[model samples]
Target chain A: MKWDFTSVFANTDALLAGAAGTLRIFAICLVLGLSLGLVVGLGRYARTWWFYLPATAFVEFFRNTPVLVQILWFYFALPMLLPFEISPLMAASLGISLNSAAFSAEIYRAGIQSIDRGQWDGARALGMRWAQAMRRIVLPQAIKRMLPALTNRAIEIFKMTTLASAVAYVELLQQGKLIASLNYNPIEAYTAVAVIFLVFLWPLVQFTYVLERRLKRDE
Target chain B: MAYQWDFTPVLANAPLLAQGLLNTLKVTGTSLVFGLALGLALALLRLSSRRTFAWPAGLVIEVFRTTPPLVQLFWFFFALPLLVGIEMTAFMAAVVTFSIQSAAFFAEVFRGGIVSIERGQWDGARAIGMNHGQALRRIVLPQAVKRMIPAFMERAIELMKTTTLVATISYADLLFAANEIAQKTFRPLETFTVAALIYFVVIFAFSLVARQFERRLAVSGESTVR
Candidate 1:
């Protein structure tokens, strides 16, 4: 068996397109997931049942189910109920973003909960309401502690973008499939794809490690 | 017009879905067992002072942990066969990929648990004339494994969810079964909903049990490693 990557390298345009698709979805999911997660996390942290119960349910349902199932459901089943068709990008984004939101909500909740009570008390003493305290005092400090975990979530989200390929979204892995089938070079094609992901993610993974170590040292 | 909901077709194919669920469990269980064993080996190697043993194990863990499971699955299923000159079945591919992928995760859990064991435990074992391996097996591991239970359970649950990826490679796991049923019955709404619900029930039950165990450990004042 000989190793050959000329076939893979020859299809630079295809791979470049896949990388763009991967980055686009990753950006969408990251922004949507992290922001929505803050809302849900706050809901979970709420004292009232109305806020807590629904947030808990949303987190539980999304966390327990596989992301692939959710993506497939959105892609295949959801259109049945909707007036218009759901695109691959839309379905995959919905599944990944919601799943990331559910997972990250826990991170946010834990981050918030880890803050000292005195911080809240001090905020209150300064004439701050709940919203004001959370936005100005609690979240700023909490986000520092949450940074490492949030970075890890971002990595997971990046890895998950590949699953969009299952629904035929033109992600990195999907393009690898195209190259492999076209060139009959699954070995080179797949290896190149894996290498590309490693190149993209390894630095991020190392950065998270650095953040974790620094956080550990600081705390 | 309202899209009328129907479950008749989905219900009629209960047996197929059930079989799929069983296959899903089968893959999960198989992968979990192998992953745990391989993970221990990798952890041990990684923890070794010898650079040769530790470096390769670290590479394997990082590479597997870093790559997406679906990419690993495709490589094992498609690329491996031609490289190794063997016929790779979907089940075999799924098992191999998930076991290794999950093993990479489990390796960290083992390393963390082992590291969490205090230096005094090692000293105490050595004072009693126990060798390194003997001390590890008799002293360190027994204590470490207890602390690792929560982490192990969490990784096991993640592995179960990941088994769904096998469906992409044409493995007739629960999700694949759902696809076939949906196509055959043209009741994708009902079919996928049931499939997702089934996964939720099984995985959620496991989560509850794990949480219960974690609580017990907490009540006992045992610090568990993540």
Candidate 2:
């Protein structure tokens, strides 16, 4: 019938607070997920059973299950096994970070695998150790190729930050829920939230496209 | 005290969990079918020469792809009914949100697959006295669809995982069932673990099958679209 956004705009402070929560979790998960992914990715790429098998299992389990389930498990179920309770932020971050790690591990492994054996041979000829070769030679080139995919993963992590709301983690969507119910402006409130996300993510999505195209051309 | 793990309560509610699994499959299957069809249509429209057709399709794909599925689900479930003056069921909202959300992803896969087909195929079809639609249906799509299988299977697996969101909207999906059993039995640790395992088994099987297909495709020397 009628459209109104005043209710949404009036709650700018609440939305701003929500945005901070969303960003905090996003930053936490992004850093933890990607860094841990590199380790797990190396493990997956390893020939040793001790390294590979557990990495493989972790990737499969986390990748196969829905993230919401993981968050809920950490929030509700895990406390029973531990001496203390898990906070909403901690549980959500753990679930999202682990899930992102599993997904990104594959990306990292692929990127690492894409490097030619000659590079390794060259590194060996230069008297470099395995870690030295990986750090100095292989990963530098591999990261260039992995840029688009990794950026895409970053965008995914940003979108997934909303799932923190499922645990009442005070993220954007959770705040939108509060706004909608309090103001009885579900349409305006939800629409505002969606627009805010689109605003936040559209540029990142476009950047990925640009990176993909550039990578395509350079390769 | 070390918590003693028990599965008896979770095991006793097997039927409920089974029903939830069925519902999960139902949503995944329904959404997959619709998403594929809508995605193809969107892809075709996006590839059209006319700006009118292409622009709108691009908008839909970009908007849906950019937004979080959970937000989309909430909008459909809570906001849409009031906007349109209709009673919306949780299942209807879940299906609608997931279908269009997945369709956005599928559209790109379709577009990529279609474009990956060389220009010569279209020229050859046109030379054979085939119109655009017939050429696409008989020649282009068959070949493109083959390259798309791996990507399609991957998206389908993602869709199944995403269907868990319906539990949030009060749909009795597997994750929701886990919640109910956990609350009823106060064995959340066991209940959630089992639920996670059930999801893993089903989704992992699909992943394995998809990998098998990918291997066979590779053996056939057919390069696939992402």
User: Number of the top candidate by lDDT?
Assistant: 1
Model 1, residue B115: C-alpha shift (Å)? 0.6
Q: What's the lDDT for residue A157 in model 2?
A: 95
Candidate 1: residue A186 Cα off by (Å)? 0.3
- Itemize residue pairs with steric clashes in candidate 2: none
Q: lDDT per residue, candidate 2, A1-219, as tens digits?
A: 699999899999999999999999999999999999999999999999999999999999899999999999999999998999899999999999999999999999999999999999999999999999999999999999999999999999999999899899998999999999999999989999999999999999999999999999999
The per-residue C-alpha lDDT of model 1 at residue A214 equals: 98
Docking class for candidate 2: high
Which regions in candidate 2 have their CA more than 4 angstroms from the true location? Answer: none
List chain A TM-scores, every candidate, in order.
Answer: 0.99, 0.99
Query: Which 10-residue window of candidate 2 chain B scores lowest in summed lDDT?
Result: B87-96
For each candidate, the alpha-carbon lDDT, in order, equals: 0.97, 0.96
DockQ (model 2, Cα): 0.91
List, in the given order, the native-contact fraction of each candidate: 0.81, 0.88
For model 1 chain B, give the 10-residue run with minimal summed lDDT: B164-173
lDDT of 1 by residue, B1-226 (tens): 7999999999999999999999999999999999999999999999999999999999999999999899999999999999999999999999999999999999999999999999999999999999999999999999999999999999999999999999999889999999999999999999999999999999999999999999999999999999
Q: Which stretches of candidate 1 lie over 4 Å from their true place?
A: none
